[model samples]
Target chain A: MTTKTPEQINEDLLRPLEGTSPRYLAALTFFVLVVLAGAAAFLHQVYAGLGVTGLNRPVFWGFYITDFVFWIGLSHAGTLISAILRLSNATWRRPVTRCAEVITVFALSIGAMFPVVHLGRPWLAFWLFPYPSERGIWPNIRSPLLWDFFAINTYLLGSVTFLVLPILPDMALVRDRTTGWKKKLYHVLSLGWTGTPRQWSRLEMAMRIMAVAVIPVAVSVHSIVSWDFAMAPVPGWHSTIFAPYFVCGAIFSGIAALIIAMALLRKFLHLEDYLLRIHFENLGKLLLVMSLLWFYFVFAERLTTWYGNGSSEMAVFWPTQSGSYAPLFWAMVVCNFVIPFPILAIKKLRTIAGTVVASIGVVIGMWLERFLIIVPSLSHKYLPYSYGSYRPSFTEIIITVATFAGLAMLYMLFSKIIPIISVWELKAGEVTETATAPALARPEQVRAD
Target chain B: MASVNSIYGLFADPDAADRGVNALRHAGVAQDQIVVMSSEPHEGHAFSLLDHKTIMPWLAALGGVVGGACGFLLARYTQVAYPEPLITGGMPLVAPFPSAIVTYELTMMGAVITTVVTLLITARLLKWKQPLYDSEISYGKILVGVLGPSGAARTDLENRLRSAGAEKIKTTGQL
Candidate 1:
């Protein structure tokens, strides 16, 4: 690793925030336009009716629900990983934590929108809130969707707090270095931080508490999302394993998304010096573990379902295994397992480019996994007379595409506004590393790689 | 409130800052009177431990207990308030299992929020008036100082800091 002074680290990390190039503006404009199109499509859907989308009686939940699950799962990338890394005291997490946390905040905001968008009268979505009203009715606490409303909101708040607390000092650094209106903007954002020992110690204490607190919240958020399906009597959806299965798949896809986001930031922001190859390799190894875990869950779930062979369950399973959904199912399997397994398992193939390729496959495969879980079970009910098929409408497709563009735009804007890396944490790491380097060089600690 | 007549010293090395703290203590400055600040945490260091004890965890737990009680009451009161005929068929009012989910979420929310609030209060965040500060602290320097000392004490403190290898000594605000 190349050693950089504190000044160099600050300059390199803050460079992206200093200036906006034409290419960046163009990319921003393009993303904005795509997102606008998505909003327009949603508006049209609202102006029309549920008929505008490819949704029906038996197939009530379609692309919107699938997108909801997929984005929520993707949100597992940041806070969970960062919290776990911090708890485990992984030193390399310094550069990667902020970017990962940013993803959690942004992806979650986007994911939370789908439930609103799916509503026939989204304007009345506030009814989901459990506040007292003139009618004296409350949101059903027994319902998983209500649980979702509370869980997702709590997670979002916790995530934003987790992301913001550490930013105060970095913002103070910007406040000190810059002048004019930029100084004033950072002044407020920095919350008048003077870096007193009490302040630093308190901040550290708060972070410790949040790190311990957020893990269970994250796990429960996905578990609650899973319970949305599991609580129902639907054949494939009603299973005890759904919670763990969803949580594992969530972390799996989350790591993949984090890898993709890091690659982009490393490329665009010129962070090659900071976001080193070792970070990617370490994350790639994690992805490999999650891949194996994901496969195990899928295999176990399928084996049980197949062995049980209840007529209603097989009715839903056969279509996914050999019928109309077979192609998509096989594609999901290949993307989630076959492609990533080899690329990640072999050390030689686990380079930056190789992990990115595997991550892309995992992202797609995870989306398909969500879609297959929702659609096939809903479409193939136990009663043959009530059986139906579903496909996404142009509106659903446009909105789904828009969500990705929207997330990218938020991420780009966030990178420009805030230093994407934690400057103080890096410096702190250097101090500890310098202190510990000689001890680590002792013969017993040296590894023969 | 920021103290007036503050004397500050900037040191490029934490060890020098540590010496400054020791010198201040030796020169009759109380441990509470010496203020130290740095860009990063120096855990287990003397300056980090000075005046650093906190009650944030206990307070956050109280917040969680309060929030959980509110969640339980909200769920139960609202359920019982439902008109007798409007009750969902056969299902009992105020099911413990479902209500526990809301309780858990709100408990976490309350704890997280209270923790942040406690940090702000204890750290004195957003206080526009700050004690003797140096922007160079952000550039990998440690700051050690005595806030609002007497005129005679200020000179002695400055001398101690200079002797302790302070790169720059600064006095700010009214004496």
Candidate 2:
């Protein structure tokens, strides 16, 4: 219920884009250097062949594939959540939608790079495309990997359009307010937006359709990623529950990522008033729900696997439960469930700091979840003689770390170029709030409700 | 491009803009001649209802159909047309289920891309010539104006907008 004029909102939101601090530069430079190091490692790997990494006969899909799934799951943070919130007409979503959508685009882009990074022959990666080639062979349309190529590409395109549609007016606002090359740049970016009623109406309509259209695309993207494992007939991965489990875990981790990103933006960008306690409380409740859902999926997957007692499945199950991978398994449980469950479930403990703690745990836990799902199952495949354990080499580790840094750097640079918060959406919300119930616009009234 | 004449007035509030629209309409401005613009959508207001019923949804559906066909054919024809079709994962060469996934993704992409293109075309965005424009629209002001009104009609429209509580009135051509 913190009321702000459109002018104040614009000034506050646009302030971050106007200038750079030494801290921002230092952070960007650090991220870029880390990314460059990752690139160097990737080059080394490409030159040295896939043997430089941890891949063996059995555990070929190791850190890179795990990173791929984790990042793609993390990408569910933005477009899916934002679309749902917009469709649901969540009033608190005004300040959150843009940041959330930005995460999806960046995270998805980074996630999509892993398949290329992990390729034995990176140059031959274009074979994944559907084009007719000189070799006279088309990619197998039936492969889950091909489905992934289509799904991720579609989601990325859909997400970019989703993010760009709402940014037009904000760009126009910047175009009008600034001068020189910045103005020229924003003018081109804005595409001659005049904010005519027709334009606004059409934009709103398009957003509505996108919100509806993108949810399934997002769902299908993660599900296809899961199928990449499930279709393999590996002991633990070949399950009917893998698709929904991955999708739920995706939203779970995605929400956690969103919370952490929002917290950082609030602290660093001075969006304290805009990203309020109520927003955190609401998102914390969502995190709690997803955490429970994630736990349920894990329990259901395990309970059925353990009860069925198929020797092949148990081969993968025992190591994850009480054998070599037990520590990581229990840690994943603690991070994804035990620690977050109570913090998020308790109202008093679900403050910004509390949620951030829980979110960090979930982020780590989800990464572990992806790792456990890929590695343990591969290591314990039914053939005992072919059993192998994978440990990531320096190259894999550096590239993995680089992807995280790359996402942060992209987000940082994007914030500088575009208003992190949607200015006009806030204004629109304010107008609606003032018009519908002026009395409810009071801070005390809003708090009591 | 020739400089088309336009007269516009900026109003601080939407109600005033609505009133300005009403005044212009009362002063015999054609429905198509009147143009209203604002930074945010003012749905349910008369100003926002200008040609509001659009063919965007239909066109998007058509795009989806076209994309679906292209995707289906791309998957089926490409696999079949290959001199030696490789049956993957024990599935048929022309796998319906997998083809459906490709079709679904392409259909959504087609719809999304078409929606944006339709919005741009229907909203008349990216025009090289700036039609009636005022920077104040970005400052939470509503612009009410007439595009290509006759020289004799310019004074009448400006007077109506001014009397209807326009904070500022502007002209882009000789009046």
Candidate 3:
């Protein structure tokens, strides 16, 4: 096959989103309003101290911390799918990398803010930094909290770098295609790229380095986040398996978020041809593998705790399985483990609709999983007399809604600015095919003749 | 040293430059007598025809060891220097679990940073004075280089490249 003309490729890549449908616009407006409301509530919390939220003495971290973990966990999908897949040369990752990376950048920003939000004195949160303050004390490096500061910062920098590097070539393409301020913006961002052999080699090399580099950072970041809880002396929290458990769960929820993102972008951007059914099928396979792994971790964790039958561990386990939070606990198991196992297991049901449904279940189940991890331990501390149930207030709910809205808004804005799919990588793949196909086809031609 | 009798040079797209080197070997060029030079670093697989091997992975491994050591020091030495006099349940002041966290973080950070730095150094990047091939190669092309006898050998190499779908060919000075 002859190479498609640049004009045809440009048309294929930049087909304008069918002007935002009324329903879509209305939904977006509603989310924006909800986000504003949440922001207002957050402002109230900041002004009035965390006192405005339902977080009390025992339940110092409630929705905000859970959301923090959730958001950070969501960030893993991009690096995992994009960088990891790229290194392995998984061609299927081509369509999903941009959205995944964008989700990562946004999710990291959002997740990074929660620690600040959780701080009672938000203004004094700078105290976490290891600077010479009015107090002569440095942050205790021994503390997991301090480790979180390093881990999150490293993760954020790595994720941002990972996101921006690949986008440079795509930005150049966008600059070439568009006009007016967007073109100027793209031009300024594209760094005077002329597609020289040296530049391409360097670019590809940088991308390869980044892809290989980001995977471990991504894994370690979430593992450290899990350590924030697990390293605590609290009985239920002091499990060695927490690291892998958290990592698997992060990947699970991250993939689910990616699925939802792909579906939305596919619908909104009309990217069905580029992000085809096969991509979804591949993602479904990943989800199934992760689902089984997550289930295994969960089972191993429970069986160990149950077999040990330690009083404090059992105390936490009982509430999780059959006590006050049993409904949430069981629902988490069904959603995260049970539902995904079968739906993703069957090949016939691993289509777009099935994967999407399974993804939704995963998102819900993972959220519930966070809730299960958090509330149970806090509700069952060593001294039984001190343990108490946590109930989140309306303010907390509003802020949660706002944070999600903010994430969506950031994603929407990103799409409008840069392509949701990497135009350059797609083009590069196309060019590779064009370059190689003639050589590949000659044997066939000779055979045919 | 024997007077360098021949100034050998050839230009190619990166892929052709790569394949040309291998073809050079088949055409009776020795590993030491030939060099592949290009506008950028080509794949190591292409350099299999050469005498010197790439040193990137060795540097990466060294970085990993240093990083893991640093992590160990961070995890183990904290208690030693500060002396947390109070002990909890006789757990060693330097816990293995938390130490593993540090080890993992530092090891990965080291490996990644080293890999990046090695690539940059090997590719000879960020130098303002480096020469370049045509800009179009950046738009999805490759460049290959071979150094040997300039006249007949270069022509034969050019013919080989053209047959392999190389769009253009040129020769430069000694390197």
Candidate 1: tens digits of C-alpha lDDT, residues A368-402: 99999999999988899999999899999999999
lDDT of 3 by residue, A142-186 (tens): 667767776777677667767776666666666655678877777
Q: Tell me the docking grade of candidate 3.
A: incorrect
Ranking by lDDT: 2, 1, 3
Please report how far candidate 2 places residue A118 from its true position, in Å.
0.4
Candidate 2 residue lDDT tens string, A117-201: 9888999999998887677788888889999999999999999999999999999999999999998999889988988878888
In the order shown, the candidates' Cα RMSDs to the true structure are 5.7, 5.7, 7.7
As for candidate 1, its clashing pairs are none
The C-alpha stretches of model 1 lying farther than 4 A from their native spots are A433-449, B1-3
Against the unseen true structure, what C-alpha lDDT does each candidate score? 0.89, 0.89, 0.71
lDDT of 2 at B80: 84
Decide which is better by TM-score, 2 or 3: 2
Clashes of each: 0, 0, 10
**Segments of candidate 2 deviating more than 4 angstroms:** A433-449
Candidate 1, residue A386: Cα displacement in angstroms equals: 1.4
